[model samples]
Target: MVIQEQIRIQTRGRNTYNITGEVSEAIGRAGIETGICQLFIQHTSASLILCENADPSVRTDLERIMSRLVPDGDPIFDHTLEGPDDMPAHVRSILTHMDLSLPISQGRPALGTWQGIYLWEHRTHPHQRNVTLTL
Candidate 1:
C-alpha cells in the first residue's frame, strides 16, 4: 500500500522543528505496518534532518555552528534580493538534506529513543513549510 500526504509546518524563523509526532500520526493513519517512510520537503531554503531531540542544547549548538559556517550578509553572495538571509538559507539547505527515509514497523516510524525528525528552517523569517510523506 502507498499513502502520501502533505504536512504544513509553521516555522519560527531559523530554527529546528521537531515533526516526529506529526510523522508518526501520519504513519498511523497510513496503516503500513512494514514498509519505508519517505519524507520530502518542498522548499529550497528549508531542509530535513534526524537528530537528537532529547536536549534543546543540541539544536541550539547546531544553529550556532551553522550560522558561523554560513554567516548571513556575506558580501560575496549575489542573491541578495530577498534579504541578507536569502543566500545563506539556500547554502544551509545545501549543507543539509531535502529528504529522509525511515523504516516503518508496527505501523509506526522506527525512530530510536532520543531521535526525532525535524524541519530545519534556514530563513530569517517565519514561513509555512510543506513536507510530503510517503508510506
Candidate 2:
C-alpha cells in the first residue's frame, strides 16, 4: 500500500522546527504496520534533518556552525535577488538534505529515542514550507 500526505509548516525565520510528532501522527493515520516512510520538503531554502532531540544546544551549535560555513551576503555569491540570505540558504539546503527516509514499524516512525525530525529553514525571513510524506 502507498499513502501520501502533505503538511504545511510555518517557520519564524532561520531556525529548526521539530515536526517529529506531526510525521508520527501522519504515519499512524496511514496505518502502515511496516514500510518505508519518505519525507520530502518542497522548497529550496529549507531542508530536513534527524538530529539529537535531548538537548536544544545541539541545534544551536549547528546553526552557529552553518552560519560560519555559509555566511549570508558573501560577496562570492551573486544570487542575492531576494536578500543576503538568499544564496546562502540554497547552499545550506544543498549541503544538508531535501528528503529523508525512515523505517515505519508498529504504525509509527522508528526513530531513535533521542532523535527528532526537523525542518531547517535557512532563510532569514518567515515563510510557509510544505513537506510531503509517502508511506
Candidate 3:
C-alpha cells in the first residue's frame, strides 16, 4: 500500500530551497518500508529538481542559469497577473520539472550521498508551495 502527504512551504523566489529533509520526514511518517516516493508540485509557476545536497554554490549557479534563460520581463510574455515574473515563472516551470520519483528504503527516501530535492520557486515574491508526497 501507498500513502500520500502534502508538505506546504512559503518561500522567496530567486534561489533553490532544499526540501530533502521535509520529504524525508514525510516519508518517515508514512512508515513505508519499501516503495517509490513521488513528489509533485501543484503549481504551474513552481518547479522541482534534484540537486547537490551539500554545496550551496551549485544552487547559486542554478539561479544564475535561470536568470539568463528566463529574464524577469520579456516582451514576448502576455500573462503578468502577479508581476513581471508571473509569466516567466510559468516559462521556467515549463523548462524545469514538475514531479520527481525517489526510491524508498527502510522507511526513508533513498537519496545519493550528495543528492537533495529542491523546490525551485521562480516567482517574484514569497509564495506558498505545496509538495505532494505519494509513497
lDDT top scorer: 2
Candidate 1 structure quality by residue, lDDT tens digits, 34-116:
99999999999999999999998999999999989999999989999899999999999999999999999898989898899
User: Rank order by lDDT, top first?
Assistant: 2, 1, 3
Candidate 2 lDDT, 46-90, residue by residue in tens? 999999999999999999999999999999999999999999999
Best by TM-score: 2
Candidate 3 residue-wise lDDT, 16-133, digit = tens? 7889889988988878889999999999998999999788999888889888898988988888778898888998999999999999998888888999999998887888999898
Task: Between candidates 1 and 2, name the one with more favorable lDDT.
Answer: 2
For every candidate structure, what is the RMSD over all alpha carbons to the true structure, in angstroms? 0.7, 0.5, 1.0
Clashing pairs in 3: none
Off by over 4 Å in 2: none
- lDDT of each prediction vs. the true structure? 0.95, 0.97, 0.88
**Candidates ranked by TM-score, best first?**
2, 1, 3
What TM-score, over all chains together, does every model reach?
A: 0.98, 0.99, 0.95
Q: For model 2, where is the 10-residue window of minimal lDDT? A: 104-113
